[model samples]
Target chain A: GAGVSQSPSNKVTEKGKDVELRCDPISGHTALYWYRQSLGQGLEFLIYFQGNSAPDKSGLPSDRFSAERTGGSVSTLTIQRTQQEDSAVYLCASSLLLAGGLDTQYFGPGTRLTVL
Target chain B: AQRVTQPEKLLSVFKGAPVELKCNYSYSGSPELFWYVQYSRQRLQLLLRHISRESIKGFTADLNKGETSFHLKKPFAQEEDSAMYYCALSGLANFNKFYFGSGTKLNVKP
Candidate 1:
């Protein structure tokens, strides 16, 4: 079975540009998540989607960051007006379920974004 | 405020020697703990979880609520075990939001 997959392994853009990173979660997985890994920093939660309910956007760092999961499978994280601080590896993960259950999240290769 | 802590950023051990990676977490409610590992050029993957009570690759972790720790331990270290290990915590009430540690890079020398 294919694990979580992400597109555009690497991306480079100038400051103030907008970029979107894509993620294809494992088939049948009901949960999707996005995280950012800055240099020498731990993985920071970004957003989460489960089934068809409202997503948990508490982890999103700023208003410039937004994510959406369509058809409950594919997810996209968009960073508007990119900043030098946004340079990091954007990671996506998925799990079978997350609501009051024990699940392990499988991660994708990640998209390394560089904002110059 | 849920948080996971990995005090050591890097740990070096010799082949065939015992290995221990310390992890501490802070959360008010009951928490589910997990250990994630990423080998060189590999994506992060779950190594083990506290709920499963199973060991993978000779590694085991005992969750201690009293001490608020879930340290990964192995009797003998293998060169293949060298990688980056992250300690993560998920709150019981929250929707499986994982808070990861700073991660520990393990180096095993033969």
Candidate 2:
């Protein structure tokens, strides 16, 4: 079984540019999540999607940080007008359960984004 | 407010020595706790969960509601155990959205 996977293992962009990071969750996993891993910041939850319900964007640091899960499998995190502060590893995860059940979250290899 | 804390950023232990990684959490309601691990060049993966009440790879954690802690421990550390560990919490109040700790990097010397 394929685990959660993120594309563009590494991405380097200029400040003010927009970058899109992709994530492919495990098949049949209804819950998808995005996180940011940075130095001294740990893992910060950016957004979450469960099935068709609205996403939990409370953890998103700013309006520039946005994510979308299409067809309930693939997700994309887009950082608009990227800033130096946005330089971090973007991680994605998926769980087997739905409806708020506590399940193991399989993580992706992460996309290392650098805003130079 | 829901939060997970890992006081130590780094912990070093010798092979065959006992190891403990402390974790504390703050949440208004009952929270499900989990320990995730990441080895070098590996993605983060589940090491254990409080609900499962089981041990994996010679590691175990006891969740204490009274003390608000869930620390991972092992009787004897192995060099292969060296990696990053993260403590995470999820509860109904936050709709099961996990709040993760800053993570602790463990170094086991042989």
Candidate 3:
């Protein structure tokens, strides 16, 4: 089975520019999550989507950061007016079900975003 | 606030030696813990979860509610075990949101 996949494995953008990172969750997955990994830092929770429920936007760092999951499969994280602080690896993961304890999340290869 | 903590940034062990990676979490409600691993050039994947109480690839973790810890351990380390490991936590009420630690990089030398 195909694992979670992210696009533009690497991206470079100038400060103040906007960029979008895409994620294709595993087929039949009902849960999707976005995280950011900064250099020498832990994975920071970004956003989450479960089935058709309202998305959890609490983890989003700022108003410039936003994500949307369409049809419960594909997710996109968009950062408007990119900043140097936004340079990090954006990771996407998906789980078969919504149970946190029982469902195991599978991660994608991550997109390394660099803001110059 | 829910948070996961990995005390050690790196752990080095010789092949055939015992290995332990410490993880502690703070959560007010019932917590779900998990260990995720990433080998060189590989995407992060689930290694084990506390609720499952199952070992994978010679690794096991015991969750201690009293101590609020879930330390990952293996009887004998293998060179192939070298990789980055993350300890994650999620609350029973907020299962979809995972709080991850900084992660520990393990190095197993032959």
Model 1, position B21: C-alpha lDDT score: 100
**Runs in model 2 with CA error above 4 Å?**
A98-100, B92-95
In model 3, state the lDDT of residue A29.
85
What does candidate 2 score on TM? 0.95
For candidate 2, the lDDT comes to 0.90
Task: Please report, as a value between 0 and 1, the fraction of native contacts recovered by candidate 2.
Answer: 0.72
**By DockQ, is 1 or 2 better?**
1
* Global CA lDDT computed for model 1: 0.91
lDDT of 2 by residue, B14-110 (tens): 9999999999999988788989999999999999998888989999999999999999999999999999999998884354377899999999998
Report the lDDT tens digits of candidate 2 across residue range A12-102: 9999999999999999888888899997767988888887454567788999988888797899999999999999999999987745464
- Worst 10-residue lDDT window for candidate 3 chain A reads A95-104
Quote fnat for model 1.
0.74
Supply candidate 3's per-residue lDDT for B59. 100
In model 2 chain B, the worst 10-residue window by lDDT is B89-98
Candidate 1 stretches with Cα past 4 Å from truth are A52-54, A98-100
